[model samples]
Target: MGLRVSKGQSIAVRAFLSVLCLGVACFGAGCDGNDQSSEYIPENGAKIGASVADVMKDWLEDPDVPAAQRAVLERVAATGDMESLDYEQSWAQYRQCMTDLGYREIKLQKYPSGLYIEALHLAGTARQESKYEEDRAQCTAEHVEYVQAAYAMLAGNPNLYEDADEAVVDCLHRENLVAADYTASSFAEESARGEEDDYSFDIRDMKARSCLASNGHLTAFIGDDVEERLW
Candidate 1:
């Protein structure tokens, strides 16, 4: 699932391009090398579960909500669960949409988790980069945007800890990456100060980085070498 974060929501939804554009697996293989693209990747929990209506309120209630986003809201409303995306089906729809828009050489690979794009040389075109971006954005918005966002959030933090910051600290301590006595207060203070603040572990350490990214506290760009399938 390639979910891009929208700044409109205060939710910790990170950009999906971190996963999609770099050809990384949404969960299994981290997109540790992304452009930190404003979209693609998972979003998640804080213990306070989000209902379809709750998330929809981010855009649906707007008097000027775009027809496309409104459509996504309706689709999610029908499913009643964000994790309910039909990966194969949405990928098919998205593939055809991209092809129709002239990105015909598309190809996909299957991974243990889901389908992914092995080579979407979006850079293959000589067209203006801006134009390509516009088209790509349109296609994503219509088909995969919101569903993928919800999927990423749930996938990365399956427990859906409503307080993700606390969760990250917990994971660090659980993994023995930090002193057992480290507290959430320490985690918050440190996270607020960038990498210097340590609830017990160095945020930049490989294992620590993984814990932060996995818990939605930081972004880690993985090596481009990992295998993937795009759906």
Candidate 2:
């Protein structure tokens, strides 16, 4: 899960609550007993999507990937599910780490992507705040960052799209939320106007909202079908 620190509310959480989101969660999950040393490689095939095996194959060769991340990848490969990455557990670890650091009332919000920071109450002198930043960085890095990325690889845009906008546009079209004559070009134009004036499709429209939420956009204007957790 990714998090943003804020005093009043979280931008990501607010955006998430505004749209109806949809997701499929697999019930069964497990990982193969793969030797996770320098000799490790992803022999397990893709369980979630066709591309996951390929992604795991590439990441195995990248030296920057930490053992924790690689282990999560192996689990994802074995189970064909993002939950195998165990990001929620890691987020809990992160939350506990922050709480132990003296941060009180660390509110969290749930999103289709995962847990997000709804609010954080940070108070101290400038020097202490600076030290807090350093600690937050350390805690987040050790607990959430890479595991969250691995989970996102599956949870975000089931199509594994490189462009979030394009994925959302395609999803809108696939769900028949837009007119048959609507083109990506038209959507692009609307997006420009939408940003400048917030003139996008009415977020209150249920189909449109769900399409936007699932395809990875348009979850910032309405509220339904979500969970808010205080962490």
Candidate 3:
């Protein structure tokens, strides 16, 4: 999955994350208190009760979806922007693409926190950190990770072979590797802190493995889950 960078906004990651947060909230609140028969309506506080796994499972079972769309969705599930599409024309184009692919009614929940996270990321990336060296360095490092991971996954797929820039490919590979190391270390630290249970530990490890397999490393841009934790 190539990350198309421009002067405007990036929506894929933000939208996916919004869905994840919404799904998590729904699952957490509804699992015990409410019945599954209770449809998750957007209003009346039902949408806020869906779980992350529930939403993810729905995406996995969607019949009309193709592998390419799923892969892209999965890649950005942690950070897809679902806020107002007013930044650029591409936001509309991407939304249209997803609708055409039949994911219009993908999630019946609304997670406002996802928008907050996206806004934070956009703000951080948008600002020139001339006064704060540490923040600037961290931001640069994070961007490198995101770009690298996307390219690494893209490179591993033969169907997405597009010849263009040698330098970009090399940079992506290098950053991907670095990201992997950092992710593994971070997981270990979190485990030590008892911040992860068996399921979460396994999920984190799987993410590390997935990134490693796709990019041969985990670049600084370690995807949405890890980034959310940072926030």
Candidate 4:
């Protein structure tokens, strides 16, 4: 349950990473020569709610899951009422189920969109991590597939920023910011590695988003057309 953000109909998965990287590094005088503000955690309440609904849909239909549990999840899903939902309790049940199955070190972290489950080290045999991974894949295959497809589409398109205004790039340079040449392919690879290695923060930060916005890249990065395609 990694937290993701978006503006309007688009889930700014990459945007979330971009901003997160900035928030972590730029605030420390390491990149932007400015002190990082602890208060600047990116927020997109609308996106968070939408993302949870998306995940819940898959959870309810996950064939690998038990019917009883899915029924319980359906009730939980309805509790959102399109405004707010008890994410803590909803995720707690999942965590407890995993724990009952012998997965240790289960850590649940809150993100703007949803929760991220970190089953760091499992108990039992030497192949504990492998076993846990198998179970997780089986449980959340549909949700995982949807996310992978979205990221893959984003990664494949290299010219996503071509339409961005030149002023955006100029502003980034003027600010002395470090901007990565982001592409759909590069993002896909990075995203895959982040999951495989269990890298926290989803392999992105706030700097990227801040730099892009300062340079006027948001229009290109999060245009309505792009949102429709990604969502």
Candidate 5:
């Protein structure tokens, strides 16, 4: 048997159909091409979100910000939170603080190479000082001891070795084996190349000591136990 539509249900169905038809016509007219003056549709929430995203993208593209600062901002953005960049104004304040301390922009061509030049200059100065030479040699020796111990520990523990990446393991092995070889090869290389800048700690500390006090002896004794005086 076929289903039958009752008279009362048919009347209700006509009313509902009439309402739906009116709604469709209203929606179509409201969104017609004639409404070109409307910049956006209130029904679409995406326009506002997209505009905000574009503004943020533009801000991120600004090159004046330091690479470190940009890295942190990018990490925050990657977290999918927009509110984290509220601290950006605070970064401006921080930059002003750095500017007050004599920070300035340098060309990339002159940046790290300039740093190397300065380091070499300081190292040259340290080489001129006897006391700095001794202390730095001692510090280097202590560092080498640590390196040797690290390598010894790594060798005995193969499972421990597996935990670290190959580069790290290689570094440990190199540290263990390189010290003697480096010392030997350095002399030959220096002999062949002529004396080049060592840029060691002796020169660095001597320059620092000079800046602080005229009496290098007194400055060197700055950490001495004054309580040991019996006289």
Candidate 6:
């Protein structure tokens, strides 16, 4: 996950909260409307819609496609709303692709929001988790690219502290809190550990918060007191 420092909130506090939320897997709880599909399609909607059409054209042309599904695709294309395409179909294809590639115990589940692939069984080993992430990335490459492009565009905005990210990294390095090239992957591993351990804040978290605060990246507050000051 990306670090989320607010305008006035210290980066240290934000890092603390980020770790806390990751530990509990509650970071996305309020993300009901934050679907990748709703991101602003920079450059008039046609480009992205066309990209989706190109990727799915072959699947749509298959004789096995249901008439109703075909109608939905046609409607989505006509309206340039690529998010309306059948995600269930794409998910099935992804699962099949992973299985064909020798992944076992791959399961998909539907929540109220959307489908999610569960590969925890595949995460038993570092190599297994790496392979699972790689294959899963391959399966969702097209969609991932589109969403990443949208986020990249958003990050390009000058108003959203685009430069601040680097500054925070620099601060962390100067304090010997993290490596110069510390990445989100580092935090992701920590988050996975937090989840497995039932969300307990640990020494690493304390050090991160302390580093941010000492570097003038955080404010003093405790527990819910910080929540009241949120932007």
Best by lDDT: 1
The residue-by-residue lDDT of candidate 2 on 118-217, one tens digit each, is 2323346778667766776677666755555445445543454444344444555554455444444555575545442342344444444444444334
Q: TM-score-based ranking, best first?
A: 2, 1, 4, 6, 3, 5
Summing lDDT over every window of 10 consecutive residues in candidate 5, give the lowest-scoring window: 112-121
Clashes of each: 35, 2, 30, 21, 2, 0
lDDT of 1 by residue, 141-161 (tens): 566555455544433434445
lDDT of 5 by residue, 126-210 (tens): 4344443343234322222222112222222122222112212222223232222223233224223322233111211323222
Superposed Cα deviation of residue 199, candidate 1 (Å): 14
C-alpha lDDT (0 to 100) for residue 183 of candidate 3: 29
- Of the candidates shown, which would achieve the greatest TM-score relative to the real structure? 2
Q: How do the candidates rank by lDDT, highest first?
A: 1, 2, 6, 4, 3, 5
**CA lDDT of 7 in candidate 2?**
15
What are the Cα lDDT values of the candidates? 0.47, 0.46, 0.27, 0.32, 0.24, 0.35
Candidate 2: TM-score?
0.54
Cα lDDT, model 2, residue 141? 60
- The regions of model 1 sitting more than 4 angstroms off are 1-53, 56-85, 107-128, 158-231
TM-score of 4: 0.33
Indicate whether candidate 1 or candidate 6 has the larger lDDT. 1
C-alpha RMSD for every candidate: 9.3, 14.1, 20.1, 14.3, 35.5, 16.5
Q: How do the predictions measure up, each by TM-score?
A: 0.47, 0.54, 0.19, 0.33, 0.18, 0.32
Q: What is the lDDT of residue 94 in candidate 4?
A: 50
RMSD of 1: 9.3
Is candidate 3 or 5 superior in TM-score? 3
Two-way TM-score contest, 4 vs 5, winner: 4
> Which tens-of-lDDT digit does each residue in 185-208 have in candidate 4?
333343344332332121223343
